[model samples]
Target: MNTQTLKKPDINILKGQTITGKWHKKKYYVVKELGSGAIGTVYLCVYQNVQVALKMSKQSHSITSEVNVLKAFKKVQGHSLGPSLIDVDDYISANGHVYSFYVMEYISGDDLPNFINRNGQEWLFTLLIGFAKDLQTLHDEGYVFGDLKTDNLIVSRKPARLRWVDVGGTTLQGRAIKEYTEFYDRAYWQMGSRKADPGYDLFALAMVILRIYYPNGFSRGDNPRKTLQQKVQLAIRSQSLKQLVGKMLNGDIDKADQVKDYLLQYVMKQNQQTQLRQKRLSQKNQQETSFHPTLEVVSILSISGLCYIYMTLFL
Candidate 1:
Protein backbone atom coordinates (compact mmCIF):
# COMPACT_ATOMS: atom_id res chain seq x y z
CA MET A 1 0.00 0.00 0.00
CA ASN A 2 2.95 2.30 0.60
CA THR A 3 4.25 1.59 -2.85
CA GLN A 4 3.69 4.99 -4.40
CA THR A 5 3.10 8.55 -3.29
CA LEU A 6 0.70 10.71 -5.30
CA LYS A 7 0.18 14.44 -5.13
CA LYS A 8 -3.15 15.02 -3.39
CA PRO A 9 -5.77 17.37 -4.75
CA ASP A 10 -6.81 20.46 -2.81
CA ILE A 11 -9.79 19.30 -0.81
CA ASN A 12 -10.63 22.88 0.19
CA ILE A 13 -11.34 23.69 -3.45
CA LEU A 14 -12.79 20.35 -4.57
CA LYS A 15 -15.15 19.86 -1.66
CA GLY A 16 -18.51 21.65 -1.66
CA GLN A 17 -18.40 22.00 -5.44
CA THR A 18 -21.36 20.59 -7.35
CA ILE A 19 -20.41 18.64 -10.47
CA THR A 20 -23.16 18.54 -13.06
CA GLY A 21 -22.71 16.09 -15.88
CA LYS A 22 -22.72 17.96 -19.22
CA TRP A 23 -24.70 15.39 -21.19
CA HIS A 24 -26.41 13.12 -18.63
CA LYS A 25 -27.50 16.17 -16.59
CA LYS A 26 -26.92 14.35 -13.33
CA LYS A 27 -25.57 16.37 -10.39
CA TYR A 28 -23.19 15.09 -7.72
CA TYR A 29 -22.34 17.09 -4.60
CA VAL A 30 -18.78 16.48 -3.58
CA VAL A 31 -18.62 15.56 0.10
CA LYS A 32 -14.87 14.96 0.28
CA GLU A 33 -11.85 13.81 -1.66
CA LEU A 34 -11.42 10.08 -1.42
CA GLY A 35 -8.03 9.62 -3.15
CA SER A 36 -5.86 10.89 -5.96
CA GLY A 37 -3.49 9.20 -8.38
CA ALA A 38 -1.59 9.96 -11.53
CA ILE A 39 -4.71 9.49 -13.63
CA GLY A 40 -7.26 11.44 -11.54
CA THR A 41 -8.71 12.32 -8.20
CA VAL A 42 -11.57 10.33 -6.69
CA TYR A 43 -14.12 12.10 -4.54
CA LEU A 44 -16.87 10.89 -2.28
CA CYS A 45 -20.04 12.50 -3.53
CA VAL A 46 -23.75 12.44 -2.93
CA TYR A 47 -25.84 11.54 -5.96
CA GLN A 48 -29.61 11.21 -5.87
CA ASN A 49 -29.54 10.97 -2.06
CA VAL A 50 -26.95 8.15 -2.18
CA GLN A 51 -23.20 8.25 -1.61
CA VAL A 52 -20.99 7.38 -4.59
CA ALA A 53 -17.40 7.76 -5.72
CA LEU A 54 -16.65 10.11 -8.61
CA LYS A 55 -13.32 10.04 -10.39
CA MET A 56 -12.38 13.06 -12.49
CA SER A 57 -9.44 13.23 -14.85
CA LYS A 58 -8.24 15.78 -17.39
CA GLN A 59 -7.21 12.98 -19.72
CA SER A 60 -10.06 11.45 -21.72
CA HIS A 61 -8.15 8.38 -22.83
CA SER A 62 -7.21 7.43 -19.26
CA ILE A 63 -10.82 7.75 -18.17
CA THR A 64 -11.94 5.65 -21.12
CA SER A 65 -9.41 2.93 -20.31
CA GLU A 66 -10.53 2.82 -16.67
CA VAL A 67 -14.17 2.73 -17.71
CA ASN A 68 -13.44 -0.16 -20.01
CA VAL A 69 -11.79 -2.04 -17.17
CA LEU A 70 -14.81 -1.49 -14.96
CA LYS A 71 -17.08 -2.70 -17.77
CA ALA A 72 -14.98 -5.84 -18.15
CA PHE A 73 -15.20 -6.47 -14.41
CA LYS A 74 -19.01 -6.48 -14.76
CA LYS A 75 -18.87 -9.37 -17.24
CA VAL A 76 -17.16 -11.72 -14.75
CA GLN A 77 -20.50 -13.50 -14.24
CA GLY A 78 -22.06 -13.08 -10.77
CA HIS A 79 -18.88 -11.62 -9.27
CA SER A 80 -18.55 -7.88 -8.90
CA LEU A 81 -14.79 -7.70 -8.33
CA GLY A 82 -14.64 -3.93 -8.80
CA PRO A 83 -17.19 -1.18 -8.36
CA SER A 84 -20.06 -0.95 -10.84
CA LEU A 85 -19.87 2.00 -13.24
CA ILE A 86 -22.84 4.19 -12.56
CA ASP A 87 -22.49 7.25 -14.82
CA VAL A 88 -19.97 8.76 -17.23
CA ASP A 89 -19.85 12.20 -18.81
CA ASP A 90 -17.88 15.38 -19.25
CA TYR A 91 -17.83 18.21 -16.69
CA ILE A 92 -17.18 21.88 -17.38
CA SER A 93 -15.51 23.71 -14.54
CA ALA A 94 -16.07 27.35 -13.57
CA ASN A 95 -13.18 28.34 -15.88
CA GLY A 96 -14.75 26.41 -18.82
CA HIS A 97 -12.13 23.65 -18.60
CA VAL A 98 -13.61 20.27 -19.57
CA TYR A 99 -12.80 17.10 -17.66
CA SER A 100 -13.94 13.51 -18.02
CA PHE A 101 -15.41 11.79 -15.00
CA TYR A 102 -17.19 8.61 -14.00
CA VAL A 103 -19.35 7.81 -11.01
CA MET A 104 -19.19 4.34 -9.47
CA GLU A 105 -20.36 2.33 -6.48
CA TYR A 106 -18.76 3.71 -3.31
CA ILE A 107 -17.13 0.81 -1.51
CA SER A 108 -17.17 1.54 2.19
CA GLY A 109 -14.51 -0.69 3.67
CA ASP A 110 -10.96 -0.93 4.99
CA ASP A 111 -7.87 -1.50 2.90
CA LEU A 112 -6.43 -5.02 3.08
CA PRO A 113 -3.54 -4.24 5.46
CA ASN A 114 -5.63 -2.20 7.90
CA PHE A 115 -8.42 -4.77 7.84
CA ILE A 116 -5.98 -7.58 8.65
CA ASN A 117 -4.34 -5.59 11.45
CA ARG A 118 -7.70 -4.79 13.05
CA ASN A 119 -9.14 -8.29 12.71
CA GLY A 120 -5.93 -10.21 13.45
CA GLN A 121 -3.68 -12.29 11.21
CA GLU A 122 -5.98 -15.32 11.52
CA TRP A 123 -8.02 -13.80 8.68
CA LEU A 124 -4.96 -13.55 6.42
CA PHE A 125 -5.36 -16.87 4.61
CA THR A 126 -9.09 -16.43 4.14
CA LEU A 127 -8.51 -13.00 2.64
CA LEU A 128 -5.77 -14.33 0.36
CA ILE A 129 -8.04 -17.16 -0.70
CA GLY A 130 -10.67 -14.62 -1.65
CA PHE A 131 -8.07 -12.71 -3.68
CA ALA A 132 -7.10 -15.88 -5.52
CA LYS A 133 -10.71 -16.68 -6.36
CA ASP A 134 -11.35 -13.17 -7.65
CA LEU A 135 -8.14 -13.26 -9.66
CA GLN A 136 -9.12 -16.59 -11.10
CA THR A 137 -12.44 -15.17 -12.23
CA LEU A 138 -10.70 -12.24 -13.89
CA HIS A 139 -8.17 -14.55 -15.57
CA ASP A 140 -10.95 -16.74 -16.88
CA GLU A 141 -12.26 -13.65 -18.69
CA GLY A 142 -8.85 -13.14 -20.36
CA TYR A 143 -7.75 -10.18 -18.25
CA VAL A 144 -5.07 -9.75 -15.59
CA PHE A 145 -4.98 -7.51 -12.54
CA GLY A 146 -1.63 -6.09 -13.54
CA ASP A 147 -1.27 -3.97 -10.43
CA LEU A 148 -2.36 -6.35 -7.72
CA LYS A 149 -1.22 -4.82 -4.47
CA THR A 150 -2.50 -4.22 -0.97
CA ASP A 151 -3.41 -0.66 -1.94
CA ASN A 152 -5.67 -1.95 -4.73
CA LEU A 153 -7.46 -4.47 -2.49
CA ILE A 154 -10.30 -3.59 -0.12
CA VAL A 155 -11.98 -5.71 2.54
CA SER A 156 -15.67 -5.01 2.93
CA ARG A 157 -17.57 -6.31 5.92
CA LYS A 158 -21.21 -7.50 6.37
CA PRO A 159 -19.98 -10.64 4.60
CA ALA A 160 -16.26 -9.77 4.79
CA ARG A 161 -15.41 -10.01 1.09
CA LEU A 162 -12.27 -8.91 -0.71
CA ARG A 163 -12.81 -6.56 -3.66
CA TRP A 164 -10.64 -4.72 -6.17
CA VAL A 165 -10.38 -0.97 -6.35
CA ASP A 166 -8.57 1.44 -8.70
CA VAL A 167 -8.64 -0.96 -11.63
CA GLY A 168 -6.64 1.37 -13.90
CA GLY A 169 -3.95 -1.30 -14.16
CA THR A 170 -6.18 -4.01 -15.54
CA THR A 171 -5.19 -5.02 -19.09
CA LEU A 172 -6.03 -7.63 -21.68
CA GLN A 173 -3.81 -10.70 -21.81
CA GLY A 174 -0.48 -10.24 -23.71
CA ARG A 175 -0.54 -6.44 -23.53
CA ALA A 176 1.87 -4.21 -21.64
CA ILE A 177 0.70 -3.42 -18.12
CA LYS A 178 -1.10 -0.10 -18.03
CA GLU A 179 0.08 0.82 -14.52
CA TYR A 180 2.01 -0.65 -11.63
CA THR A 181 3.75 0.06 -8.31
CA GLU A 182 7.43 -0.83 -8.34
CA PHE A 183 7.21 -2.88 -5.18
CA TYR A 184 4.62 -5.18 -6.73
CA ASP A 185 5.97 -5.08 -10.26
CA ARG A 186 7.84 -8.15 -11.53
CA ALA A 187 10.12 -6.01 -13.62
CA TYR A 188 11.33 -4.25 -10.48
CA TRP A 189 12.40 -7.58 -9.05
CA GLN A 190 14.17 -8.49 -12.29
CA MET A 191 12.25 -11.79 -12.38
CA GLY A 192 10.15 -11.08 -15.50
CA SER A 193 8.86 -8.46 -17.90
CA ARG A 194 6.06 -5.93 -17.45
CA LYS A 195 3.81 -7.89 -19.80
CA ALA A 196 0.20 -8.52 -18.78
CA ASP A 197 -0.09 -12.21 -17.92
CA PRO A 198 -1.34 -14.52 -15.19
CA GLY A 199 2.22 -14.97 -13.90
CA TYR A 200 2.61 -11.23 -13.61
CA ASP A 201 -0.42 -10.93 -11.36
CA LEU A 202 0.62 -13.92 -9.27
CA PHE A 203 3.99 -12.36 -8.65
CA ALA A 204 2.29 -9.21 -7.48
CA LEU A 205 0.11 -11.26 -5.15
CA ALA A 206 3.24 -12.72 -3.59
CA MET A 207 4.57 -9.22 -3.02
CA VAL A 208 1.26 -8.27 -1.43
CA ILE A 209 1.73 -11.07 1.09
CA LEU A 210 5.18 -9.75 1.91
CA ARG A 211 3.73 -6.29 2.41
CA ILE A 212 1.12 -7.66 4.82
CA TYR A 213 3.78 -9.37 6.89
CA TYR A 214 6.26 -6.54 6.61
CA PRO A 215 4.03 -3.51 6.80
CA ASN A 216 7.06 -1.21 6.75
CA GLY A 217 7.90 -2.65 3.29
CA PHE A 218 11.36 -3.49 1.98
CA SER A 219 13.84 -2.45 -0.66
CA ARG A 220 15.37 -4.46 -3.49
CA GLY A 221 18.82 -5.41 -2.28
CA ASP A 222 21.91 -6.40 -4.29
CA ASN A 223 20.28 -9.76 -4.90
CA PRO A 224 16.58 -9.03 -5.35
CA ARG A 225 15.50 -12.64 -5.72
CA LYS A 226 17.57 -13.84 -2.79
CA THR A 227 16.39 -10.93 -0.67
CA LEU A 228 12.77 -11.80 -1.42
CA GLN A 229 13.35 -15.47 -0.71
CA GLN A 230 14.95 -14.68 2.61
CA LYS A 231 12.12 -12.33 3.55
CA VAL A 232 9.55 -15.00 2.67
CA GLN A 233 11.36 -17.58 4.75
CA LEU A 234 11.47 -15.23 7.73
CA ALA A 235 7.82 -14.22 7.60
CA ILE A 236 6.23 -17.58 6.73
CA ARG A 237 7.08 -20.57 8.91
CA SER A 238 4.43 -22.92 7.57
CA GLN A 239 5.80 -25.19 4.88
CA SER A 240 2.59 -25.15 2.86
CA LEU A 241 2.23 -21.38 2.99
CA LYS A 242 5.86 -20.91 2.09
CA GLN A 243 5.56 -23.36 -0.77
CA LEU A 244 2.56 -21.61 -2.28
CA VAL A 245 4.21 -18.19 -2.08
CA GLY A 246 7.48 -19.57 -3.44
CA LYS A 247 5.67 -21.04 -6.41
CA MET A 248 4.04 -17.73 -7.17
CA LEU A 249 7.27 -15.74 -6.82
CA ASN A 250 9.21 -18.27 -8.94
CA GLY A 251 6.58 -18.28 -11.68
CA ASP A 252 5.88 -21.93 -11.04
CA ILE A 253 2.19 -21.37 -10.32
CA ASP A 254 0.73 -19.09 -12.99
CA LYS A 255 -2.95 -20.01 -12.60
CA ALA A 256 -4.99 -18.46 -9.81
CA ASP A 257 -7.03 -21.63 -9.40
CA GLN A 258 -3.84 -23.56 -8.66
CA VAL A 259 -2.90 -21.17 -5.88
CA LYS A 260 -6.44 -21.38 -4.48
CA ASP A 261 -6.36 -25.17 -4.45
CA TYR A 262 -2.99 -25.24 -2.72
CA LEU A 263 -4.25 -22.95 0.02
CA LEU A 264 -7.46 -24.97 0.51
CA GLN A 265 -5.45 -28.16 0.88
CA TYR A 266 -3.19 -26.52 3.46
CA VAL A 267 -6.19 -25.28 5.45
CA MET A 268 -7.87 -28.68 5.36
CA LYS A 269 -4.69 -30.38 6.53
CA GLN A 270 -4.35 -27.95 9.46
CA ASN A 271 -7.98 -28.53 10.48
CA GLN A 272 -7.45 -32.28 10.48
CA GLN A 273 -4.32 -31.97 12.59
CA THR A 274 -6.19 -29.80 15.08
CA GLN A 275 -9.01 -32.34 15.40
CA LEU A 276 -6.53 -35.18 15.91
CA ARG A 277 -4.79 -33.29 18.72
CA GLN A 278 -8.12 -32.61 20.43
CA LYS A 279 -9.12 -36.28 20.21
CA ARG A 280 -5.80 -37.46 21.70
CA LEU A 281 -6.09 -34.99 24.58
CA SER A 282 -9.65 -36.19 25.31
CA GLN A 283 -8.50 -39.84 25.47
CA LYS A 284 -5.62 -38.95 27.81
CA ASN A 285 -8.02 -37.17 30.18
CA GLN A 286 -10.33 -40.19 30.29
CA GLN A 287 -7.49 -42.56 31.18
CA GLU A 288 -6.29 -40.24 33.97
CA THR A 289 -9.84 -40.01 35.35
CA SER A 290 -10.23 -43.84 35.51
CA PHE A 291 -6.74 -44.37 37.07
CA HIS A 292 -7.40 -41.92 39.94
CA PRO A 293 -10.49 -43.85 41.14
CA THR A 294 -8.67 -47.23 41.08
CA LEU A 295 -5.72 -45.79 43.05
CA GLU A 296 -8.07 -44.43 45.74
CA VAL A 297 -9.87 -47.77 46.15
CA VAL A 298 -6.60 -49.71 46.44
CA SER A 299 -5.24 -47.33 49.12
CA ILE A 300 -8.46 -47.62 51.17
CA LEU A 301 -8.30 -51.46 51.06
CA SER A 302 -4.66 -51.49 52.18
CA ILE A 303 -5.49 -49.19 55.14
CA SER A 304 -8.43 -51.36 56.19
CA GLY A 305 -6.30 -54.58 56.11
CA LEU A 306 -3.61 -52.92 58.25
CA CYS A 307 -6.21 -51.82 60.87
CA TYR A 308 -7.72 -55.35 61.14
CA ILE A 309 -4.31 -56.94 61.63
CA TYR A 310 -3.42 -54.45 64.35
CA MET A 311 -6.73 -55.14 66.22
CA THR A 312 -6.37 -58.93 65.97
CA LEU A 313 -2.79 -58.84 67.19
CA PHE A 314 -3.71 -56.62 70.19
CA LEU A 315 -6.68 -58.87 71.12
Candidate 2:
Protein backbone atom coordinates (compact mmCIF):
# COMPACT_ATOMS: atom_id res chain seq x y z
CA MET A 1 0.00 0.00 0.00
CA ASN A 2 2.85 2.41 0.79
CA THR A 3 4.69 1.64 -2.49
CA GLN A 4 1.53 2.20 -4.56
CA THR A 5 0.77 5.54 -2.84
CA LEU A 6 4.34 6.87 -3.30
CA LYS A 7 4.95 6.12 -7.02
CA LYS A 8 7.29 8.64 -8.76
CA PRO A 9 5.69 10.62 -11.57
CA ASP A 10 7.23 10.26 -15.04
CA ILE A 11 7.74 13.47 -16.97
CA ASN A 12 8.40 13.65 -20.74
CA ILE A 13 11.78 15.38 -21.05
CA LEU A 14 12.67 17.31 -24.32
CA LYS A 15 14.90 20.09 -23.06
CA GLY A 16 18.10 21.47 -24.68
CA GLN A 17 17.76 19.19 -27.72
CA THR A 18 16.25 20.16 -31.08
CA ILE A 19 14.40 17.02 -32.15
CA THR A 20 11.99 16.68 -35.05
CA GLY A 21 8.88 14.50 -35.00
CA LYS A 22 5.44 14.29 -33.44
CA TRP A 23 6.64 15.80 -30.19
CA HIS A 24 4.65 17.50 -27.40
CA LYS A 25 1.34 16.86 -29.15
CA LYS A 26 2.96 16.48 -32.59
CA LYS A 27 1.80 13.54 -34.77
CA TYR A 28 5.04 12.13 -36.15
CA TYR A 29 8.54 11.20 -34.97
CA VAL A 30 11.35 13.20 -36.61
CA VAL A 31 13.96 11.04 -38.29
CA LYS A 32 16.43 13.45 -39.90
CA GLU A 33 16.63 17.01 -41.06
CA LEU A 34 16.28 17.25 -44.83
CA GLY A 35 16.58 21.01 -45.31
CA SER A 36 15.39 24.40 -44.12
CA GLY A 37 13.56 27.12 -46.04
CA ALA A 38 12.51 30.71 -45.42
CA ILE A 39 10.01 28.98 -43.15
CA GLY A 40 11.07 26.59 -40.39
CA THR A 41 13.08 23.36 -40.81
CA VAL A 42 11.92 20.47 -43.00
CA TYR A 43 12.34 17.10 -41.38
CA LEU A 44 12.02 13.57 -42.64
CA CYS A 45 9.32 12.41 -40.27
CA VAL A 46 8.02 8.97 -39.43
CA TYR A 47 4.56 7.82 -38.44
CA GLN A 48 3.68 4.16 -37.91
CA ASN A 49 7.17 3.35 -39.19
CA VAL A 50 6.45 5.17 -42.49
CA GLN A 51 8.30 8.21 -43.83
CA VAL A 52 7.01 11.64 -44.81
CA ALA A 53 8.19 15.24 -45.18
CA LEU A 54 7.04 17.57 -42.42
CA LYS A 55 7.53 21.20 -43.41
CA MET A 56 6.87 23.60 -40.56
CA SER A 57 6.43 27.32 -41.20
CA LYS A 58 9.27 29.76 -40.48
CA GLN A 59 7.29 32.98 -40.78
CA SER A 60 3.81 34.31 -41.42
CA HIS A 61 2.03 33.14 -44.60
CA SER A 62 4.86 30.83 -45.72
CA ILE A 63 2.86 27.60 -45.56
CA THR A 64 -0.18 29.45 -46.88
CA SER A 65 1.49 30.06 -50.24
CA GLU A 66 2.77 26.49 -50.51
CA VAL A 67 -0.60 25.06 -49.58
CA ASN A 68 -2.37 27.39 -52.00
CA VAL A 69 -0.03 26.48 -54.85
CA LEU A 70 -0.44 22.77 -54.11
CA LYS A 71 -4.20 23.13 -53.97
CA ALA A 72 -4.18 24.82 -57.36
CA PHE A 73 -2.44 21.83 -58.94
CA LYS A 74 -4.99 19.48 -57.39
CA LYS A 75 -7.77 21.30 -59.21
CA VAL A 76 -6.11 20.53 -62.53
CA GLN A 77 -7.69 17.51 -64.25
CA GLY A 78 -4.52 15.48 -64.77
CA HIS A 79 -1.34 16.43 -62.91
CA SER A 80 1.01 14.21 -60.93
CA LEU A 81 4.27 16.15 -60.93
CA GLY A 82 3.85 17.70 -57.49
CA PRO A 83 4.01 15.60 -54.34
CA SER A 84 0.69 14.32 -53.07
CA LEU A 85 -0.64 16.07 -49.96
CA ILE A 86 -1.03 14.08 -46.78
CA ASP A 87 -2.14 16.28 -43.84
CA VAL A 88 -1.81 19.83 -42.51
CA ASP A 89 -1.55 21.09 -38.92
CA ASP A 90 -1.21 24.59 -37.46
CA TYR A 91 -0.05 25.89 -34.08
CA ILE A 92 1.78 28.72 -32.32
CA SER A 93 5.51 28.32 -31.72
CA ALA A 94 7.23 28.67 -28.35
CA ASN A 95 8.28 32.18 -29.40
CA GLY A 96 4.63 33.12 -30.12
CA HIS A 97 5.14 32.58 -33.85
CA VAL A 98 2.08 31.07 -35.54
CA TYR A 99 3.18 28.24 -37.84
CA SER A 100 1.56 25.69 -40.16
CA PHE A 101 2.94 22.25 -40.85
CA TYR A 102 2.47 20.27 -44.04
CA VAL A 103 2.75 16.50 -44.19
CA MET A 104 3.86 15.70 -47.75
CA GLU A 105 4.67 12.49 -49.58
CA TYR A 106 8.27 11.47 -49.01
CA ILE A 107 10.16 10.76 -52.23
CA SER A 108 12.80 8.12 -51.57
CA GLY A 109 15.49 9.13 -54.00
CA ASP A 110 18.38 11.47 -54.66
CA ASP A 111 17.29 15.05 -55.26
CA LEU A 112 17.74 15.96 -58.93
CA PRO A 113 19.50 19.27 -58.26
CA ASN A 114 22.29 17.62 -56.26
CA PHE A 115 22.65 14.72 -58.70
CA ILE A 116 23.17 16.99 -61.70
CA ASN A 117 25.85 18.93 -59.87
CA ARG A 118 27.74 15.65 -59.31
CA ASN A 119 27.03 13.50 -62.39
CA GLY A 120 25.41 15.54 -65.15
CA GLN A 121 26.49 13.61 -68.22
CA GLU A 122 26.47 9.95 -67.28
CA TRP A 123 23.24 9.16 -69.17
CA LEU A 124 22.45 11.78 -71.76
CA PHE A 125 19.75 10.75 -74.26
CA THR A 126 17.60 8.93 -71.69
CA LEU A 127 17.30 11.80 -69.24
CA LEU A 128 16.64 14.18 -72.12
CA ILE A 129 13.57 12.22 -73.21
CA GLY A 130 11.93 12.17 -69.78
CA PHE A 131 12.90 15.77 -68.95
CA ALA A 132 11.67 17.16 -72.26
CA LYS A 133 8.38 15.33 -71.89
CA ASP A 134 7.83 16.64 -68.39
CA LEU A 135 8.70 20.19 -69.46
CA GLN A 136 6.20 19.94 -72.27
CA THR A 137 3.55 18.71 -69.87
CA LEU A 138 4.18 21.66 -67.56
CA HIS A 139 3.99 24.03 -70.51
CA ASP A 140 0.67 22.57 -71.60
CA GLU A 141 -0.72 23.13 -68.11
CA GLY A 142 0.67 26.71 -67.96
CA TYR A 143 3.21 26.08 -65.19
CA VAL A 144 6.96 26.63 -65.12
CA PHE A 145 9.24 25.35 -62.38
CA GLY A 146 10.61 28.72 -61.24
CA ASP A 147 13.80 27.07 -60.04
CA LEU A 148 14.94 24.72 -62.82
CA LYS A 149 18.34 24.02 -61.33
CA THR A 150 19.60 20.44 -60.85
CA ASP A 151 19.04 20.51 -57.10
CA ASN A 152 15.27 20.87 -57.53
CA LEU A 153 15.15 17.68 -59.56
CA ILE A 154 15.40 14.17 -58.04
CA VAL A 155 17.31 11.23 -59.48
CA SER A 156 17.43 7.64 -58.22
CA ARG A 157 19.31 7.15 -54.97
CA LYS A 158 20.27 3.48 -55.42
CA PRO A 159 21.80 2.04 -58.63
CA ALA A 160 18.58 2.46 -60.55
CA ARG A 161 17.04 4.79 -63.17
CA LEU A 162 17.33 8.56 -62.56
CA ARG A 163 14.05 10.32 -61.77
CA TRP A 164 13.05 14.01 -61.67
CA VAL A 165 11.01 15.48 -58.80
CA ASP A 166 9.91 18.80 -57.21
CA VAL A 167 7.56 20.28 -59.84
CA GLY A 168 7.10 23.96 -58.95
CA GLY A 169 4.05 25.02 -61.00
CA THR A 170 3.86 28.80 -60.61
CA THR A 171 6.74 31.26 -60.97
CA LEU A 172 7.89 30.30 -57.48
CA GLN A 173 5.72 27.17 -57.25
CA GLY A 174 5.45 28.44 -53.71
CA ARG A 175 4.08 31.83 -54.74
CA ALA A 176 0.58 33.28 -54.89
CA ILE A 177 -1.45 30.12 -55.52
CA LYS A 178 -4.67 31.86 -56.52
CA GLU A 179 -3.00 33.65 -59.45
CA TYR A 180 -2.42 30.66 -61.76
CA THR A 181 -3.14 32.58 -64.96
CA GLU A 182 0.49 33.62 -65.45
CA PHE A 183 2.50 31.03 -67.39
CA TYR A 184 5.90 32.61 -67.12
CA ASP A 185 8.81 32.18 -64.74
CA ARG A 186 10.09 35.66 -63.87
CA ALA A 187 13.61 34.62 -62.89
CA TYR A 188 14.82 33.45 -66.29
CA TRP A 189 17.24 35.92 -67.87
CA GLN A 190 18.34 36.01 -71.50
CA MET A 191 22.09 35.63 -72.08
CA GLY A 192 22.63 39.08 -73.55
CA SER A 193 19.43 40.45 -72.06
CA ARG A 194 18.72 41.99 -68.67
CA LYS A 195 15.39 41.01 -66.94
CA ALA A 196 14.33 37.44 -66.13
CA ASP A 197 11.35 36.36 -68.22
CA PRO A 198 9.30 33.28 -69.19
CA GLY A 199 11.38 32.65 -72.30
CA TYR A 200 14.45 32.53 -70.08
CA ASP A 201 13.03 29.45 -68.33
CA LEU A 202 12.60 27.71 -71.65
CA PHE A 203 16.08 28.75 -72.64
CA ALA A 204 17.25 27.48 -69.26
CA LEU A 205 15.69 24.09 -69.96
CA ALA A 206 17.36 23.92 -73.34
CA MET A 207 20.62 25.02 -71.80
CA VAL A 208 20.39 22.25 -69.19
CA ILE A 209 19.93 19.68 -71.91
CA LEU A 210 22.65 21.16 -74.07
CA ARG A 211 25.17 21.43 -71.27
CA ILE A 212 24.52 17.91 -70.04
CA TYR A 213 24.15 16.14 -73.39
CA TYR A 214 26.63 17.87 -75.72
CA PRO A 215 28.31 14.92 -77.47
CA ASN A 216 31.53 16.36 -78.84
CA GLY A 217 35.15 16.07 -77.74
CA PHE A 218 34.77 19.69 -76.64
CA SER A 219 31.86 18.94 -74.24
CA ARG A 220 28.83 21.17 -73.55
CA GLY A 221 30.50 23.63 -71.18
CA ASP A 222 34.02 23.49 -72.61
CA ASN A 223 33.39 26.09 -75.31
CA PRO A 224 33.84 29.83 -74.79
CA ARG A 225 30.79 31.53 -73.24
CA LYS A 226 29.78 33.62 -76.26
CA THR A 227 30.31 30.67 -78.61
CA LEU A 228 28.00 28.49 -76.51
CA GLN A 229 25.29 31.15 -76.54
CA GLN A 230 25.68 31.41 -80.30
CA LYS A 231 25.39 27.62 -80.69
CA VAL A 232 22.14 27.43 -78.64
CA GLN A 233 20.74 30.54 -80.28
CA LEU A 234 21.59 29.15 -83.72
CA ALA A 235 18.71 26.68 -83.40
CA ILE A 236 16.40 29.53 -82.21
CA ARG A 237 16.63 32.16 -85.05
CA SER A 238 16.93 35.89 -84.24
CA GLN A 239 19.98 36.67 -82.05
CA SER A 240 17.49 36.61 -79.15
CA LEU A 241 16.41 33.44 -77.27
CA LYS A 242 12.76 33.18 -78.29
CA GLN A 243 12.57 29.58 -79.49
CA LEU A 244 10.48 28.32 -76.56
CA VAL A 245 8.31 31.46 -76.29
CA GLY A 246 6.15 30.81 -79.36
CA LYS A 247 5.63 27.12 -78.63
CA MET A 248 4.80 27.80 -75.00
CA LEU A 249 2.10 30.26 -76.06
CA ASN A 250 0.75 27.97 -78.77
CA GLY A 251 0.19 25.22 -76.12
CA ASP A 252 1.47 22.72 -78.66
CA ILE A 253 4.97 21.21 -78.39
CA ASP A 254 4.92 18.28 -80.82
CA LYS A 255 8.09 19.66 -82.34
CA ALA A 256 10.03 19.25 -79.08
CA ASP A 257 10.52 15.50 -79.70
CA GLN A 258 12.52 16.22 -82.81
CA VAL A 259 14.65 18.69 -80.87
CA LYS A 260 15.43 16.15 -78.12
CA ASP A 261 16.45 13.56 -80.71
CA TYR A 262 18.73 16.02 -82.45
CA LEU A 263 20.35 17.01 -79.14
CA LEU A 264 21.21 13.43 -78.12
CA GLN A 265 22.36 12.41 -81.59
CA TYR A 266 24.61 15.38 -82.22
CA VAL A 267 25.65 16.26 -78.66
CA MET A 268 25.97 13.09 -76.57
CA LYS A 269 27.65 10.96 -79.25
CA GLN A 270 30.41 13.45 -79.87
CA ASN A 271 31.02 13.91 -76.15
CA GLN A 272 31.26 10.15 -75.59
CA GLN A 273 33.86 9.87 -78.32
CA THR A 274 35.90 12.62 -76.75
CA GLN A 275 35.74 10.94 -73.34
CA LEU A 276 36.83 7.63 -74.88
CA ARG A 277 39.82 9.25 -76.52
CA GLN A 278 40.95 10.77 -73.22
CA LYS A 279 40.49 7.43 -71.45
CA ARG A 280 42.68 5.69 -74.02
CA LEU A 281 45.38 8.28 -73.57
CA SER A 282 45.33 7.68 -69.81
CA GLN A 283 45.61 3.92 -70.31
CA LYS A 284 48.57 4.42 -72.65
CA ASN A 285 50.33 6.53 -70.02
CA GLN A 286 49.85 3.78 -67.43
CA GLN A 287 51.31 1.20 -69.84
CA GLU A 288 54.34 3.41 -70.47
CA THR A 289 54.83 3.92 -66.75
CA SER A 290 54.56 0.17 -66.11
CA PHE A 291 57.11 -0.71 -68.84
CA HIS A 292 59.60 1.96 -67.77
CA PRO A 293 60.18 0.45 -64.28
CA THR A 294 60.89 -3.06 -65.62
CA LEU A 295 63.25 -1.75 -68.29
CA GLU A 296 65.22 0.28 -65.71
CA VAL A 297 65.62 -2.78 -63.44
CA VAL A 298 66.81 -5.04 -66.32
CA SER A 299 69.28 -2.40 -67.47
CA ILE A 300 70.73 -2.09 -63.96
CA LEU A 301 71.14 -5.90 -63.66
CA SER A 302 72.90 -6.06 -67.03
CA ILE A 303 75.30 -3.26 -66.09
CA SER A 304 76.13 -4.87 -62.67
CA GLY A 305 76.85 -8.30 -64.32
CA LEU A 306 79.19 -6.68 -66.84
CA CYS A 307 80.98 -4.70 -64.11
CA TYR A 308 81.69 -7.91 -62.09
CA ILE A 309 83.06 -9.75 -65.16
CA TYR A 310 85.27 -6.80 -66.07
CA MET A 311 86.59 -6.54 -62.50
CA THR A 312 87.49 -10.28 -62.34
CA LEU A 313 89.30 -10.04 -65.63
CA PHE A 314 91.25 -6.99 -64.49
CA LEU A 315 92.22 -8.65 -61.15
Q: For candidate 2, write residues 195-306 as lDDT tens digits.
A: 2234434544554444343323132344344444455554443221234433432223334454455555655677788999999999999999999999999999999999
Clash tally, candidates in order: 0, 16
Model 2's TM-score against the true structure:
0.52
TM-score of each: 0.85, 0.52
- Candidate 1 off by > 4 Å: 1-13, 281-315
Clashing pairs in 1: none
The top-ranked prediction according to lDDT is 1
Give the Å shift of residue 73 in candidate 1: 2.1
lDDT of 1 at 94: 72
Candidate 1 least-lDDT 10 residues? 2-11
